[model samples]
Target: MKKKHNDHFLFYSESKTKNRITINGQEKQHAIAVLRVEDGEHIQITDGQGNLFVCEVESVLKSSIECNIVESWSVKRITPDVTIALGLTDRAHFESAIESLTALGVKKIIPVIFEHCRKPWWDKWRRYEERFKLKMISSMKQCLYPYIPELVYPTILKEVLEEDKTHMIVADPNGSTLKSEIRDKQTPVTCIIGPPGGFSATEISEFNRTKVVYVKLTPNRLRTELAATVLCAQIIGHTL
Candidate 1:
């Protein structure tokens, strides 16, 4: 069998098919200073909006480089409309959760501020997003996935519960097994996991009133990040 050609490439919105693509700004720096891609080499570019282009380098220069598009295709790889809302935790753990969920093919991620959440790191929110996007891009490249997960600004936990209409499952240590709670369900699902200290009594009551089912992962308690991963895995399996 002949080897298959890699046709899917991601580029910026400004890049055009016939025009020479001058890779500049931060992307240029990374390509030249870091990856050291040379002229005549082929690469894939995406607009991060499902548009992909295959291109070959025409010239390489400091701060900028030019490329010619050889072929192009639109991608349609996206997970089912399953969203995840996670209570804000420490920066390190939260970063892991964001990257893991993005790699797992989540549609949207909302950072939830719960009653037991630590003080908000308002100033570093943008940085967190940048890091998450970087992770998503890397995962997209590795997994050959076309769709990028959207990260929503942090919101109050109650607000998410009120706004959510899909099947909601809250990871609770004192709740029913996830397998039992989610088995045979075919609707779009949204999972919520609380912070390290867990949800307060008042918050639990609010979620209960909203008809959010509490699902437990295991008998032994797990960290907030771990719980989120477990729930996401289960949801993905159901969708598959």
Candidate 2:
């Protein structure tokens, strides 16, 4: 069986049994219309939950594609399980950050509503949740990654900081360098990136009171999205 190097080469589906998997909607359309795969052709599929199924096309329907699983295996989640608590920014920036973060294999993402955050954006976060989800999915497939980072609902920065967690790192301009802080760390980490206009004075004081390590990604300031992608890449490098 010749393999096709099309975007639909790897499909995603959550509806699967022991031996069969059914893909519908956009995934089906990509397979049937874009890739134009025929029955009996083998393709790769992921459930976006760390499982990859090597399936052979069984039937193509008007609205769905059926395949028989010939082989399957699970991919382990990235170690040190890094979660990024990014302060909410504009829709374009937030979406771009998640796309880069997802491709970098972030385990989870939490949209934070910091004191300086744009209140209007957070107030209507739910309305754009689906669009954000689709962006993450597209990034995952583009990278051929097996898992989609868990996208948590928007939460206030104060509440996020209050959560009982260890190994918390916050991005700050006056903080210790990234190299110095993350060295020799061997535990799950949650990195926080402040939104535009930076964290407020009150928020800075809140950080001072909490047990969080502040890391300076660079000598100069970075936009919220770049800071997040850079931070995530730095952590991933350290983990490796």
Candidate 3:
């Protein structure tokens, strides 16, 4: 098996100023003992929020590695701000969703609960949190960007729809095609996706009541993971 964090490795280092950072804990051990990184070698680092730093390793101490920032820059976040809310039904597919969407520069992910959602889904979601966060860190590093996408889970569908400030979109095979023409330049957007079994008729009615713009990704229905990933990528493409 491939080693963990062989390339594009990233970790959380809180720096009030971006000029300096200390990599401690197991990460420090990985660099000093395992990676055997030498002084004067440059490496990448991030604050987990948009600021990326390229630094030269000044020294490797027993407890931590110290580095001096060589270059500092910020990546521009995507426009028509996007958040993804979905019901996760498959463990492997859900991990794929997180990996793909985060690399695409999505800012937020909300794991929502709906009427068609089964009890088994909840159990799987709870068990996957640790792995999910690790996947986020990996994706954050692989993408070579700074900001870590926010992951919110166990959120209720009704409560999410009730957010008045953010404009909403729903993924349904029945709705009209979504394109740049349908994009709203003014408000932040949140796209909602349902389970593989699909939401009930009453749930669709509630979506309409909440004024969600329904869009169809494909003529045929898609799995929840594919639907959410595709919709997020499409919106991000338009914004970029």
Q: What is the C-alpha lDDT of each candidate?
A: 0.73, 0.86, 0.76
Which runs of model 1 end up more than 4 angstroms from their true locations?
Answer: 1-22, 180-186
Q: What local lDDT score does residue 63 receive in model 2, on the 0 to 100 scale? A: 85
Model 1's number of clashes is 5
The top-ranked prediction according to TM-score is 2
Segments of candidate 3 deviating more than 4 angstroms:
1-18, 29-36, 119-128, 184-186
RMSD of each: 3.7, 1.9, 4.5
Off by over 4 Å in 2: 1-8, 183-186
lDDT of 3 by residue, 132-231 (tens): 8778777877787676789976777888888774678899787777783354655788888997778889888888788788888987778888888888
User: Candidate 1 vs candidate 2: which has greater TM-score?
Assistant: 2
Q: Return the TM-score for each candidate structure.
A: 0.81, 0.94, 0.84
Name the TM-score of candidate 2: 0.94
Please, what are the lDDT tens digits per residue for candidate 1 over residues 67-171?
Answer: 887777887544455688988888888878877776677778888888889867844687667777776766665555555778888898778878746578888
